[model samples]
Structures are given as C-alpha cells and as structure tokens.
Target: MASELHEAIFMAKQERHKNLFLNYRNLNNFPVELLKDEGMQFLERLFMKRNSLTTLPENLAQKIPNLIELYLHSNNIAIIPQAIGELVKLQSLDLSDNALQIICPEIGQLRSLRHLRLANNQLKFLPQELGDLRELETLDVSMNLLRTLPERLHQCVSLQCLTADRNLLHCLPRQLCLLPDLNELSMAANCLTSLPLDLGRSMELQFVFVDNNAHLKGLPSYLYNKVIGCSGCGLALQISDMKQLCLTLGDVTVPLPSEVKAIGSESERVLPLEELACRVLHAAYDWTCKDVKLRTPFLMPKSLLDVVQWPLGHCHRCSQPMFTIIYPKLFPLRETALAGVHRSTVSFVAYCCSSRCMSTFDLQA
Candidate 1:
C-alpha cells in the first residue's frame, strides 16, 4: 500500500465517499493501508481492475462491509478469497481473465447477486452451491476447463444467458430444459455427444450455439427452427430437412400419442400437425364439390379412439368452421383390395369441418 493511497483513504473518509477507485495500479498485494482507518466501512463499490493483485484481502468483509459491486477483472488472481462470500448485498462481481482454479462454495451466499462473470479462467469444477443463486440472470463461464455443469443449475429460474462455450462438456443436463426463462444458450466447441430431446420446447429460446461439437450426434429435429446458429453439427439428412421445414412451415410434429407408440413401433414415431390440418381442410373442400347425400359417424377401436383427436384449425376454403348438424362429417372405409383405388388393406379416414366452407371450393364447377 502506497502512502499516497493511504492518505487518499483518510481524505475519502473525511468526505464520506462511498466509492474507492484504485484501478490501473501496479500493486502486488491488497492495499492493507486502507484498513488503518475503519472509515473504509462505508465503502459500497471497489474499482481494482488491471492490477497485479494475486489475491483479495482475507478480511475484506470486516474492512469494507458494504461493497455492492466489485471489479477485479484483468488481475492475476488464482484463488477467490473466501471473504468474498461475506458481501450479502453484492449485485455484480467481475472476475474475468484470471488464473482462478477453485471457486469457494460459499459463493452461493450472495443471495442478491444478479450478474457474475467468471470467463477466461482455468476452472476444472464448479461448486453445486452455484445453483443457489436464484436471482442470477447472466452467468458467463466461457473459456474454462469445465466438463459438466451441476444439475441444480436449473434452480436459477431467472437465468437468461448461459455462455459456456469452449469447454470440455460432453452431455448437457436435462434439467437445463426446465429453465422457463432461458432465452440464450451457447455451448459451442464442447465434447457434446447429444442434446436433451425437448430442449427446443423449453422456453422462448431465441439464440442457441451448439456448433463445432465433432462428436455430437444431432439435436432434436425441431430445434433447428428455434436456433439461429447450428453449423458444424452432425444432424441426420431427414432430420435436417424437417428442421428446415420447421424454419418455414414444417407445422412441427409432436410425439405419437402414448397409445399408438407400440402399435406403430416400426414406423414414424411422431406425426406432423400440418398433416391433420390439411386433411380436414381438404376434406371439407372435397365434401362440397361432391354430392355425398348421407353423412354418418362410425365406431373406432377403443385403443385408437383413446389417442385420436382433431387438432383445431381453420377451414381451407371459406375459413368458416362447419360445426352444424348438416356439416362436418367422418367417413370410414374398411380394408379391401379395391375399396377406394389402392390394392392394399390400409384403411382411409376422412374428416370435414363444415359444409359452408366446403361450398367455397370449386366455385367454377
């Protein structure tokens, strides 16, 4: 601690200043000179970036007590001082571009902290207590040696951006899909092999960067639409096509109803919502062009009925739904060689919404 800095503290005390600016100093040790006056007790912010600090004061809490923000970036810090947990009111703490190896579990003690930056460090592991930061919003842990993140991390429901790119992570925690407010996620250059199936439907995710994982199999086919950057992945050709369609009008498919999964185990496991929408819309239009005098409803197997549902959609022609007694109908045809035209035993299911909308089709007829 320099005598000039020591005198500056005394003057700050007399002036009741709440901030201390000691950045850009070539100090190799924490300024113990400030501790000479308990007047430092009122300090709420500390600016000590771009210094030669190898460590922070062990009794920092006792010396300053009221720090709400601490800027210690661009330092030679190898260990996070344990006294850091004593700052209960800390809202922002920047420890970027350091040589830190271990972060104390007591770091979870900062209940009010919202922004924490630990980028460009040599961290090999993180304390599970990190999940206790419930109010945390932006967590930047990029450029580290982390292989995996704690599942308890999902507890930070307020987290919006999770940047952990350039790490050695292999698999992502499924709990990550439970974060309802997560909007941006970056996991590029990791050792990832696969992603959670429902990561696409977790929230209003706007930006996701999972490119450059050589071993990653692929993401769920739906995620391609929600994400903006997905190059360098190994997604399947068919899945890649559907991903593109979803980016346009894939109508995004949904998992097969539980009842139908085992029966059609060898076929497509999911069905597109657009297929059902087009079916009813086109059927409604066809019902109008043809003179089908009688309308009737037939019974379906209880197993099939359990999963069958008419997804809501607008009519294709007039856009008016046919919900009347004389409108929308269901026609069932049994398996036969020539019942319709195909020489197979496959059943045909037709549905229409209403006659009014159907009447709009082939008006020139």
Candidate 2:
C-alpha cells in the first residue's frame, strides 16, 4: 500500500503538478525524505504557508534547488539563514507574518528575485545591501518601525512597486523617485510634510496615497494640479512633465534672538560661525532661557517658533528630541542644513522667539 501511494504521488508530479499547497496541516518539517524517495524532479513551486514552523530545516536550499517560488509566510520562523541565498533561481519569496527582526543581507544574492515580501514583521531596518537586488520589481516592507532608508536604495532600477506605508518614516528617501520604471508609491501614514523636489523624475508614476499625513500641507507646482480623486479609491494622480514638477526645498534663512553659546562640560564657550550654521540649521537644540533679556518686546517669526510665551521657552524647530539628563542632541529633518559646515560643531542661533525684536536692533540696517 505504501509503495503504491508513493508511486501515485510521483505520477502526479510527472503529470505537471508543479504547484504544491501543503499549508495549514501543521507541517513541521518539509517532506524532504518523502520527496527524495519519490524522485520528483519537476517541482518548481512550493507552499508551506500557515504552519507552526519554528524554523526551516537545515538543508532546505539543497533540497529545493530548482524551486522558483517558495512561500514560508504566516509561520513562527524568526531567522532566515544566509544559506537561503544559494537558491539563485528563486524569483518570489514570501516571509511575511513571521517573527523576523533582521533581514539577512545575503538575500541580495538572489539575482532572479522579483517579488520579495517581508511585511508584518518586526524588522527595524533593512540591510544596505538590499539595493543590490537589481532585478527586484515588487518589494513590500510595510507595517514596521523603519526610521530611515538606506542611501543605496536607489540602485534598484527595476523596482516598480514600493509599499512602505504605516512606518516611522520621517522623510521619503529622495532617491526613491529616481527609478525610471517605478509606478506606485504608498506612503500614507508617515511624518512626511513634503516630497523630494526631484520627485517627478519618475516617468511611470500613476497612483500615490499620501492621505493621513497630519503635517503635510501642500505639494510642488508640478504636482498641484495632479490631485484626482479622494474617496474609497483614494486621491490618485496622473502627472506629466516630471522634470518640470519636482523642485527642491527653497533656501530660506531666518534669524534667532538670544546669543548662541555652546554648552560645555564645565564652562560655556562660543562656537564658530560655519559650525554654528550647520548645527543651527540641522541640529537645533531645545533650550529654555533661564535669564533672558526682552530687548524689544519679544516679537518672533511664526515660521521659526513652534511656541513662545512671556517667560521665553523655546523648543528648537528640529526632529524628535532625544533628551537625556547629562547630554542631549536634536536631529533635524533636512540633511542639507549641514552642508558646507565645519567640524567640532558650534552652537548657532536657532529660531528666536524675539526675531522681529532683534531685527529692529540691527546695527548695519
């Protein structure tokens, strides 16, 4: 009876049953022994989804050398071994709904990989080498806590769909729109108030879901007239002349009130002008004036100050402040603010609550 059953399964494979669905049956380990004994050589697709799998078997890549599509999703797997990269012919991989925290950097070796899904995982960030997946066209990395993207992400010239919605992305990687073939981008629930000036560089873009961004106010001139619908289908857009649409953020300079002083270990020190500009623009710190002199009625620009009161308390316009008791540093949203700045960074005057007051006292003017 056992020999007859094995022969029947092998016969099914010989009849071109390449797609196998062995999911939801509490499959612990892959049926490697059964498959090897049956001599099933035409296997190309395997589905091990919805299992109680804690980890993959040690020799999975060796057993499924010809497998083009593998689905290990909705499992308890935590780690994807680097050996998985040996499957050079693999085109699609689904590891979503797992306990994976770190994406193996060796995944870039899958030269034929086109669809990679790591959604619904605990990944904090991706490997910088992920840009090496030159053939990747669809990548789903949503529902994670990724703060920033790797700078080399622009190398994936073939990427068509990138879904990174519902993450902690403060700013979209400017290089994202540089992909000439990219079509869809979903960045709904993030802190992005604006997109890259060169965002219109992509010629194939069609749909963009940028709702739910509380801080976002407007789009570039080229994208202004592109807002289409705003209902169940979401506000879609069909843009033209991408080269004329995207524009970089304008260079705007404002003044601060109080004299900038570098807080030191023992004593206060004056910072250099060049270094001060870098820090003030990029690394503005939150400070409370313990003894401030109201020079001329404390009138500040609304663009500079988030809040201002009688007893001047200034929370510098910066990214989220990582405040510590001994030392603290504020990171800004724009990296260009630090452009052409010096090292051993000095303290520059950030938005002063009394900017208008200070302007009235301008010596040259």
* Worst window of 10 by summed lDDT in candidate 2: 356-365
* Residue pairs whose backbone atoms clash in candidate 2: 197-247
Q: What TM-score number comes out for model 2? A: 0.58
TM-score of each: 0.61, 0.58
Counted clashes in each candidate structure: 1, 1
Off by over 4 Å in 2: 1-16, 32-41, 225-365
What is the total number of backbone clashes in candidate 1? 1
What digit string (tens of lDDT, one per residue) describes model 2 on residues 1-365? 33654554566566856776667757565555434653444668888799867776556667667779989889888888888888888999999888888888888889899999988888889998889989999999888778777777789888888888777887878888678787777776766666775664455765556555545544433332232111111101332322331212233333321224223423432323332333333322234544334322233453233221211111222222211000011122123333223111112222211211101011111
**For model 2, what is the error of residue 26's alpha carbon versus the real structure, in angstroms, after optimal superposition?**
1.7
Indicate the residue-level lDDT of 97 in model 2.
89
Predictions: Cα RMSD each:
15.6, 16.9
